[model samples]
Target: MSQDRDAGARLGDSSLLRKLNLAAALGAFLKAPSLTLRELRAVIGVSRPTAEDLLAELLTEGRVEETTPPRQPSSGRGAGRPARYFRFRAESGYVSGLDIGAHKTLAVVTDLRGNTLATSRRELDPELDAAGRLSAAVETARACWVEAQLAPSDITGVACGVTGTLRAAEGVHDVGHGPVGSGLAPYSLPGFTEVDVPGALSEGLGRPVAVANDVKLAALAEHWKGAAQNHRDIVYMFAGHRAGAGVLIDGQVHQGRHGAAGEIGALPMLGWEAAVERLHARGAELARSAGTAAGREGEMVITSAARQDPESLAVLIEFAEVLARGAAVLALAVDPEMVVLGGGMSRGGPILAEPFRRELAKFTLVPLEVVTSTMGADSVALGAARLALDTVFAELLAVPGS
Candidate 1:
């Protein structure tokens, strides 16, 4: 009996090692466009036979495919026959990302490597009930999948980003009582905090869903493919009709204990609410004078400022000063290397960047570079897709029964 138990232990150890080798080979393939047997063995530090075995298994599973290397010109020196190479099958599956905000819901479909394949957007009434909003988000996701010509089974993972703090309990995300003192309540969907966001999205979309704060996802988007990609520690400020922030430390989002790591705008003393209201009031006045709809008043104000409107520029400068105060608080605490300004206000471009940088410099102990988001309104949804891709890779690389 003791001998049998020892043999079982040996089998378990061998299985674990095999799993590790397989994961390493797969990671190498994902990073490089293609790899030969010798190249893969060198990368994973495995024997030639072991690397070949792993590639065979991956090929059988349809996760990898062989391809001929590019032809080389004949020279006096023999470079040897071009070695056959293998590449990861990034088209093996797909994932979906959804951004459900107060005013709009967006869905994006992506391949394994986070390349956008299809996208759909839907406008939502801020007064819509929680159920109505959830239904709209689901519809948008389905529309995106249809546009991509993919079936539900083709989706390997899904993630959703929403406004407000998310509290997870038994896989259900309870969006907490919404943000405070950010002047977004008037524009937020009613009763959004009282629903299970992940559960609703998962059921409606016919798949499991991961949920996160929209601002946090925006920060992740910046880290993944935006201005902060090269920086590890960052402060991502979402300056829209409402104000919020997201923090990244050591290249990972710092969500605090309850996933509220960057709710500094919630503090009434920060004056975030007052500043937003001031912008809104001025925008409304500008819109009325121009005989245009006030739907995008804040943007109008920024546009006017861009055109050298003195009054608009002054309001923008004051808004920047107020924003700098809250940003300084975050910068002082985290000492981030960079701060990325995103959302609608960022579209003001240099007209906004100059004043914001000038004001932020007044409070920070050390100088920090501030850049605008290039992802624009799609940042949250793109971040959601990234999260979904992560889930797919985790599952793909997971070792069974270990």
Candidate 2:
């Protein structure tokens, strides 16, 4: 019996080692796109046989495919025939990210390597109930999936970014009202807090789903492919119809025990609410004067401010001051390497940068670099896709069959 138990332990250890080798090989392919057997063995630090075995398993699983290396010019000294290569099959499966907000729902579909393949957007009525909003998100995702010419089964994972904090309940994730109630007042969707965002989305999309706060996702997007990519610690601020923040410490999102880590705007004393109201009011005035729709108020204010309109620029400065104050609070706590501004208002980041930096300098012990998001409105959705890709990789590494 003891001998049998020892044998079982040995089997487990071998299995674990094989999985690790497989993961290392997959990671190498992901980074290099294609590699010969010799190069892969070098990258993964495995024996030639072990690397070949890993390739075989991955090939059978459709995660990798054999490829011919690019033809090379003949050398005087005959270099042996170019070695065969294996390529990571990024198209083997797909993942999706969704950004659901008060004004719009956006869906992005990406390959395993996080390349955007298709996208769909839908406008939403601020007053739409939670169910209606969820439905809209589902429809948008389906449309995106269709645009990508993919079937439901082609999706390996799904992630949705919503306006509120997300909490785990009984093994499932649920959306909750955090500090600022999704950051939009009077227009915030009703009953959003009561819905299981992940479960609902999973059911609708016919795949397992994950959920996170939209601002947090935006921060992830920035770190993954936008302004904060080179920075390990960052503070991402969402400035537009509402104000919210997302923090990254050591290159990972800092979600508090209840998943509400960077909700500094919830504090009434922080003046986020008041500042947003002032901006909106000014935007409304600008919109009226410009004969544009109310929804264009923020854009009007930003445009006028860009032109150095006295009133618009002053309002922008005041708004920047409030934003900087809240950012200062986060900076003091985490000492992030940079502060990134995202959301609709990020389009005006060039105008807001100096004022925000000036105010942030006044409030913080150290001067911090401030940058605007290059991802723009797509940041949240791309971040969501990142989340989904993470889930897929986790599953692939854990399950040998996968």
Candidate 3:
């Protein structure tokens, strides 16, 4: 017995086991609501006593609370009382997600349970200086937090999605230097790529911010609550002001070595340049006619005109081919089961989907199911919130030591 005790201590501390078990139970409870002790133990693969002990730890921390167990409509007592259930105290913490795009900045605040408390959006001037745009993005975040009736300390963390590559260690998203093309390119949203995004947002919000590619974050939203729910392998295509894709393998975003795996749509030879030309021309026409902002671009004018204008519908069909070409390239490489069309352009619907399918069929051997994003443009912001929520909970309640 002494030898066994010595061996166990040598291997690891017994307290570590309890901490791990508690983390598992807390994670399971967060994912699923109102779990009875038996169900909780079974779900997390722990003994009933271990589950109860972990639950005691959670209750003592004010992280969980006993709740009424579910009952039938025509309820009758089986014994002295029904099984008790418990849930995480969702109000104990909050998180914010932010989407900083080429043309817009959006922020959403959510409780630990994934409920959206408040949200805000603002159009960004494409020609603004880097500092001004960064300021605007952080302001949008603060505004959303205030709208939610929360304070900076109340936010457990923040996650931001931006257009370019995110360098986590340096806390920035570096948009490419120089012009995207020679002159007058639609992709000419300058001063964004090299900004210290995480540093700026953190300074304003008073909490560290995690950064991810906007399209990748949109894909995360697709998997969590939108078109790609229940899917483990998916390609989420973002086709708004600029085009991008997010690849998910086994329910995780595959960001690639340089965080540039799904940038297929950026290839000039792959029809992205042509698609941008056509889409921007239409948007420019509408902007001139309406006397709106000169720099307006992306899905708004196209989708609006598509509703009634034959010319716009034709343009959309042609551009849908461009979209399909990009999807085909990604699908060929990864062979994803589903392709989710997210971003503002996803609203183009069957007019876009039908023709896109026709063109996409031209490239691949694998069968693919395509769906539009139900979350629309909000996906990125909401996805960022989800990321923040996960990190916050993991940091707050989960055990260390892997």
Candidate 4:
């Protein structure tokens, strides 16, 4: 039995072992920032020779860089040799994230550590065609990088969040294109149905681009840095121009088979479509009552009305209840511990949250800790940045499918 166990241990793949060792060293450097070879050897619990070999490997890949330490003072006997230190090069490359919506496009640039160095938002011309809109998104992305004094060449990867199902060949189109349901606008932008979004963005940005459903990216943002951090399972509901949920299960965003898992609002039977419709209708009413622009009905309008007028408050409550209906169904299916309310409507604060709780309570058997997204309007773009970093780290670390 002892011989057999020894044989099993000896049979371990040497290349895989080295990979694990390098990854461990890289992780340690990221946490420690600056670590000496002796400190890393102790932390990694490896022989000095093995640690030296791992450090060389990382240095070769530029994943880690060595630094000269300040001269050490002489001890009672003699001067101790100053050991060289290494640090994780978190800014070795940059990434960009874009959130493409009907009304506007938002872009963010970040370093490898996910620090938002700059951002830009541009409203779309409703009259523009698909090509024009794509140009606008590229322009905004360029503007963000310019604000950060970076060129597109600095970007290692780019990920985008858009308001519909993404088929690389078919571009982005609302689920309404199929009987998947509606409340979403049709693909009115000429040539949009065949735009090749990722390809277009890649060409415009001079790097490969990945596209994801916007609501799903919102969920990813919440999981990455917002209220859902560390929780494996969460439901991120976006209640702005449209209401939808981004689901995370077992610590990963659940894209499902075709990436349309949390699109319940598409079902008119769910009442989510009417919910948003009524909110806008009430906003127009309140705007007129306040002697404001009748057509100026949006997230702010709902929040203002809910806060200032009794009748508007009632409308907001109903609106929140309608969203709760969809959320209730999602919760029953996913049983997530956290639900993050986000998007433009979430700016309404308690106006949306309070009534959402009241209605969600009726259907849920257990208490769900609901919170608002701190990323605000930047949620989707930031989430896309997270995705871009994953891609960057995967290639940088030489780990496949990161």
| Most lDDT-accurate candidate | 1
Predicted candidate 3 versus true structure: per-residue lDDT over 163-252, tens digit per residue: 776555644433321234544232423665555667777887789999887888899989988878889999888777766778999998
Evaluate residue 63 in candidate 1 and report its C-alpha lDDT on the 0 to 100 scale.
89
Between the candidate structures 1 and 3, which one is better when assessed by lDDT? 1
Model 1, 1-402: lDDT tens digits are: 332234345676777778877988899999998899999988877777778899999999988999777556875755778578899988899999999887889999999977899999998877778899999999999999999999999999999888777767533233232444544342334676566778888889889999888888999999998989999999998888777889999998898887768888766677787888889899999999999975687789988988889989888888888887889999999999999999888888888888889989999999999999988888999999998998889888888876
The worst-scoring run of ten residues by lDDT in candidate 3 lies at 171-180
lDDT score, candidate 1, position 281: 93
- Pairs in steric clash, model 1: none
Q: What is the lDDT of every predicted structure here?
A: 0.84, 0.84, 0.79, 0.79
User: What are the root-mean-square deviations of the candidates from the true structure over C-alphas?
Assistant: 4.1, 4.2, 3.6, 4.6
- Model 2: per-residue Cα lDDT over 49-118, one tens digit each: 7788989999999999988786668867457885888899999989999999888999999999888999
In candidate 3 the C-alpha lDDT for residue 112 amounts to 90
Give the best candidate by TM-score.
Answer: 1
What is the model-wide C-alpha lDDT for candidate 1? 0.84
